[model samples]
Target: METKNNKVFLETIHRKLGFCSTTYVDPVGLSGGLALWWKIEVDIDIETSSKNIVHTIISDKSNSSVWAASFIYGSPNREGRDQVWDDLMGIGRTEILPWLCIGNFNEILSSEDKMGGNNPNPARFTSFHGMLSVCGLFDLGFKGPKFTWRNNRRDGDLIMERIDMAFANAKWRELHNQAMVFVDAAIGSDHNPLILNTSFPMQKVGKPFRFESFWTTKESCKSIIEEAWAVEYEGTKMVKVCKKLRGCKEKLKKKLELGFNPDYLVTEKIIKGKLEDLWQKDAMFWHQRSRIKWLQMGDKNSRFFHLSTIQRRQRNQIVKLKDDSDLWKTEANDIAVVYFVGNLVTWRTLAIIGIIPCMVQVVGVFFIPELVKIGKEKDLEATLQRLRGKDADVSQEAAEIRDYFEIVQQLPKARFLDMFQRKYAHSLTVALMVKSSFYKFVTFEVPKTLSFLNCHEHNLNQNKDLTAILVFSGIQLYVATAVGCRVRVTDSHANTLLPLDIKGSAGSLITFCNWASAWVVSYGYIFILDWNPAGTFFILAGICASTVVFVAKLVPETKGRTLEEIQASLTLFT
Candidate 1:
């Protein structure tokens, strides 16, 4: 209200808020002032003005409905309030239309409105109450903060008051019966901004379901989940999974609703312990001083006077955010209690950061060699039992793990040098499969598969869909041909050149390399294909070289030889 009527400031405001027609009361000696602005869409005329008033006549241009709105700023001091009350009485006499009296009255009607202050004077409260009664103005109900004006203090001596309020006469109330005054989130201001909304009754949104970690400690949690999952549902496996999850969600929500209470966060229990510690320290200090105890300015329990001091300092300052949720949520009072409880026991945090890793992960790493060696028919069950917690039943599981581990111990452990042996060509094929799988998934398949699935799911088909389909079919045919050739490699020659396992492994190796080549050709030139033309020749040359080498070296002329003779001939080269 004390803002200077500067040219730059006015122009900036106009640029921001647009060129709305406005009338304002300027402050006297930088003390106090007011401004009323409206769009051309709504007709507003200044009816009158005074030191603390911006009375206006507002009309709906479409409906031609009119109302008298009195924007009041009650005198800051109690002495001048009497004159403001008198002015309000005079204004009431002139009110011919439905009237709305809004803004800060700098007064409250009850002791409940003030916090951390001495009981308000009964006479002052009565005077304000009486004025509202005579003026036919009743307080319009509000949502959000019960207290609007905070004293800008977060320390123990912080004060809050509900002095600012909206009051409408009976005719005005009937005109917009659902009208509400919401105390919007405060911006660390002494007073919260008030919003008069007549559109609809604001709803206090219920909080969504949140699974708390503490629920697992309750015995009922297991029973609730089991019961919910036991309910039958008809669907595919995915649909059943979703339905069961929804059932569990509802059950957990119901259980929490019945058990949860806000009182658990009270500071009384912990603050009392803090006071006890403080008492011990204070007694020690006084005893050691040995004299002048009475001369001390403070009492024995001075530090413990108000547990309210435990709350966070300056933590109440919250700024407005674009999201609507922030508009109704004010800073909570229990923030300090949470901090006090957290700092009171720092070991919980330390245990999570330090000791937890050793118990679960670090110990497992140390035992890995022994774990791998202990493979048996039942050893997998033993590992699972260890994971489930010591209290779980594990006698049967232990036996299962032991049997499973023993069975696993009988299997061959393939080694690197084994792959080089002619009898174990399968290992080399396995290596190629692993190498190509990575490249194919990352480069060739992922982007195309994702684009295809997305297009179908979202009905996002473009004209290029047929090209994508043709490319898919071509890839399938190429893969089939490569696979069939691997099957016929043994048939092409009368030689038992490789064991069946080795032959299959070689085939897998060939198929993997084929995909790997496609991945490189598809993705490698994608970037340079835009800038240079030679990438095409480089790819074509690679294909030609691969075909020539295959025909010239890998293909053998073993047309009519017996299996044993062909094997002997290939063996000579080996």
Candidate 2:
């Protein structure tokens, strides 16, 4: 895609792409270029051209629908990027057709559009937001990878940004309301390909079973349920209940297929009338548009009213939800999907896949040798020698392992009150402060942040955004926990009394905090914060801030200090 001359590859690409007509804005020194290829069925007329954009009016010969599409290669520099927005604003004013603007804008609207590296300049956000506002363009949210552009660095300095995007105005959304933007995997380039589908295809799925209120109106329905429940089943109470409900559903389905008896025809008429009245009311609710007022007074407008009701119902319904792979799953059969071996698989497949690691571990464990500390000194040396290698020296390592094990055995057992002693007070305080704050943030605040993400699902990308948030947050949690583990190990190694017991007590604190956090997050949201996402975050921030201050004031540097020294320091201070 990066080239200065159209002759270099445009003709070949056009032919291979099966596009009848092709046009391009030549690159300015191999850095910026734009190419547009269209099939014969699409009638495209070039309306304007610039170094960064190629504006065209595209008409579908099949439907005779016309729209404007601007292919952009936004300037990478800040000053020129500002000019690109200005040009787009001018085009939005002049162009009357439903407009679509898609390409690499080389800028992002907000911090969420990027990941890693230093935060972007706020002025860039201002320019982008201003352009979108002025042009009345709404971002057509995408699926697939959250970030489209990567720095491609193998080092830790890598950065990713969602610069490539699709945007359409209100008019364009009306014309193709089902339009979707898909970010395809990047091949041989750092930038991912953006696929703008004007109409995303969806599969038709049967509606889920729901018990009708009308069914409850009949005495026969009550008899059918009772009869189904009366069938004896051999299982646990929960299983019996499930079987009964399923039986009831099947019986109701069969009864539904049989036409109403002659005796209930009057009841059917009344139910039908009530349903019609509800539909009529729904129609009245939606018929508030000025042009539909003339037909509002009589049954003459029933057809229009019914169609309006159907449209409103369809618009409000959630027929499908997008899966992790960007596929739409209409059926509710799977309550959850899990990623197995780098691919998203169904719950059934995940159950099967979940056993592989366990089986491998079970088989692999038989081939492994026992611990060196479990035997006498002679046996320990022999075991260590075999584990290391037949030829490797094991005398020094065996002696060290024996001495460490002996020391561990000689240590006194830790008691519940021993942790409260004056010498151990500082250690306990540090553990409580760190563990409480860390676990609270991890178990409680993180879910609250996820709740914030749930609120924005409609406006932003849904499942994929959630996945990205989880991925980064999980990585952060894992790395921080790893560091804490290293510190805890060091602290235990330096302790004189009941090192294992102290470690266990610290672990117990972690477990208790973790258990308490779920209740705190659940009831805390209801009673304390009233489910306010921002308020929950503000409270978490205050907790974290206070913890930071507490750590700075009370926590001592235990680095390179032995247990006796640490105890002496605490005793001197007290």
Candidate 3:
């Protein structure tokens, strides 16, 4: 036996295997099982076994089940069928046990099994009954006279055959008193199907009640009775007419459980209408509660206080409905309770009483120290000005230093210098020149000489005592001057006086090895020489050599310059 869906297929397989003797087990919304039916043959050995029993088991990809005896069997050949009968006889002989072989044997047992009476083939029936006798098996009584198999054709007189059968051992015959097959109506099939119903006297068992079934059922049977009923009461003072009728609730619940069976229960129309009414009522109640909660939780002003009270009353009503247990309770009750307790009224009251402010204070502890630090730093400008005193200019230099310190505090120390240079290029430039005047002088003069060697003269000066240095690189001549000392290089062609001045007492003019092209100076000395086309270094070397020669050739000592004589000499030089 098989079915279209695998679940049904497995179920039918189980039933045919004798695991299920009655209606097959199934969940809701599933139809009956068997699709195609066939019979098979099997053998058992009662002689060699402890108990020679034929096991019928149905197995699909998902699940399997076994039965004590099956009605479905298979054989490889005619010899296999004979061999199976021999094995059953062997079991009966050895173990003194009875055997049963049953199933859908694909071949017809007899030509008489076919419907519309073609002719009965006596030989086949004789052979099959002989095999059963040899195995000590007897046929269980069936209610049908015609065979179970027919050619699946509608127009012609259909060919039928008795393919499915059940045979049991002598022991089963004694144990089971009544077993008969019932041929059901032709349900879109030429084969009039057969079912063997055996009375096993098994008790029925009920499964656990699922809450979903009850809930869905209650929703369907809500309106069988009238909406209002007048009840008369005998009271001491006055007769009161009670109108809230909860009558017929139990009846409605039972009807819901029966489901929408049109034949036995309420009409589908009434069930559907009641279900709709229940659904709408439940949805509207929840929706109203939700809106109320939203308003109470979201509102900041007291304008909705009265509305909030009305919402609270409505919420209480909903809660009462939910708590009744009969009205179909849900898990949303806990959530509704939380919303009611945490309403806007309560939250606002807490805020007004400074409870929220206290919480804010607790939260503020972590950030307050850092904020204070920032405030102090922001006020540092005024503090720095006061620290610098009234006459202080609050120099751009000092401000920049403070800015640098601030940056260094914020950034890494390695990046502090780079950031300072980028922000204050001019200040950094002046500072660099002051720190390395000698390096700057050399750099400036060498580039100037290469660019304007014949066009201009160059002059440079350095003061060791004042730490001042200056250079003048120009056309015609190059001159470098220092504290209380000066060197002058005159244009050789002009033969003009190259002014050389030494200040203070013990100062004197010294000239040595003057050349036609260039000149150099050292101490209170001067040297003029020809330009070396080879390189500037050679020219500088020659100048230094000439300066050495001047110091040796002409030496005059002076302590410092006299102001009057220095001014007079400057006037004479001009």
Candidate 4:
């Protein structure tokens, strides 16, 4: 029915039922921009039943708000659908106690719900099921209304589908004795309106209880009077009273726990068990199907089998990882898997280039000095002839040889050898040292013969005890240590003193370098110089120059001290 103003219609419903009213508009587009919709929502508190509050909404094409209210645009393919549902459920769970979720979902629950025989996408159906489970919603049984919508085409083919549905939450299920759906007669429209009847009795105003004068005193309390009354009865009355009190206490405790410990109490075990049971049931069905040829012919039942199989596998995985003993272990395993895959990809890329430079660099760094010394003494056949031809400028030749030796010394032997080995021996050694020192700082160990002072301190803190030593031994720590060693080496080469005196900040710097390398590795080609030999030499020279500067300026001095003491002594040197 049309009213003078659209607001008046909601007001009239509120006056008839005596309940609070509110309206919600769903935004247009998946990204959540405001849009026009024709939707009206009404909440009625019927004096008939404490829990029987009617929430109804009606909308049409004139107001696009109805479409938004029903989350028409919030499809799986569209963005922010999950967030919208989460927010909607949060509000519905809090404000509405006994919820009756009825609207045009704009999506079908299953292929059976649609008129056409066209196959439905499994992924979309899975997403719909997930939404239903997340909200803890169940379909209210409707026998009369088979279809709510029909095809608008002029063709002889008449296709009808049930796009509209009614869902109820746990609260509604508790108070509702019975529910049934009635399909109203269609009046030229392509859709049918559904009428729901719930069996709930009307409630009357309750009278306030009056207390006697003696009840005001603390000693003459309600519990004492109830106990006296129970004592007057037989053994059955005492047992019933005790049972009633116990039930009330248990219920109160549960209510308090639900309010205060919601996060910890929301266990998914029941859901997981249900999923597992589905798998076992399906397995039995498959065995039965294998034995009977008629069952094999009817393959439609296999749909449930497939769905349950997938859900069972997923739930099993979640349960395994969520177990108390397996949480951190599973996380560590996942981290290791990622690390292994990344390392494999990196090594594969290097192998494709067929460059043996790392190997050559390793041989040169470790064995070149010995080889050069031996070659000088054993291969001296051309020395006399070269001396005769050039008047034997001994001093100049010696100077040139000395310069070559110095350049060789600055070739970053340990760093180059590590790259060649691909085992990161030197980096791993430093990391172990750092980890050991960190452990020592955090752990308290008693010596075989404790001093008097140590014994006193131990006695003072007797109540508290420490267990489960923190060990950062994994890919995360390994990567951090490698980056730290590289940064230290780079600084040493450039002769620059890094700001290592700041406590705990060195780790932060190393972490930044590790993160930065991920982005830098992608743009390696941008830093490539000319391919000519002279250009290569120039690039090498530049590296040497930078190394010298870093060594002089940034590298911190760590000649004869442990890592733990290094931070404390940093300021003394500077």
Q: Which residue ranges in model 1 land beyond 4 Å of their true spot?
A: 1-11, 61-64, 153-157, 202-373, 381-574
Candidate 4 accuracy as TM-score: 0.25
Better of 3 and 4 by lDDT: 4
* Model 3 steric clash total: 47
Model 1 TM-score (2 dp): 0.42
lDDT of each prediction vs. the true structure? 0.57, 0.65, 0.39, 0.41
Model 1 whole-model lDDT (C-alpha atoms) = 0.57
Model 3 spans with C-alpha error above 4 angstroms: 2-68, 74-99, 107-111, 116-120, 154-157, 186-193, 200-574
For candidate 2, write residues 1-574 as lDDT tens digits: 3445555677775675456787777776757667777767788999998888889999988778999998888887989998999999999888899999999899987898888889887876798899998888877777678899999987778899999988888778777766667777798889999987777654346867777644555688899999999998889999999999999999988888894354566564578666765555445444542125666443445445444443343344444555443344544443123223325554345444544544443322222212433556776667566767899998888676666556655678665567667666666666554544244453444554644545445233335556567646854764465455445433333233224545545445543553444334443443344356556556665654565566457655666877666555554324
**Candidate 2 vs candidate 4: which has greater TM-score?**
2
Report the C-alpha lDDT of model 1 over 519-570, residue by residue, as the tens digit. Answer: 4444443333334334433443354345345434544445676655644544
Which prediction has more favorable TM-score, 1 or 3? 1
Which residue pairs clash within candidate 2?
Answer: none
Q: What shift in Å separates residue 341 of candidate 2 from its native position after superposition?
A: 12
After superposing candidate 4 on the true structure, give the runs of residues whose Cα lies further than 4 Å from its correct spot. Answer: 1-84, 89-96, 156-158, 200-574
| Shift of residue 416 alpha carbon in model 4, Å | 99
Cand. 3 TM to true fold:
0.24
Q: What is the TM-score of each candidate against the true structure?
A: 0.42, 0.42, 0.24, 0.25
lDDT of 4 by residue, 127-155 (tens): 55676676666676564557877877655
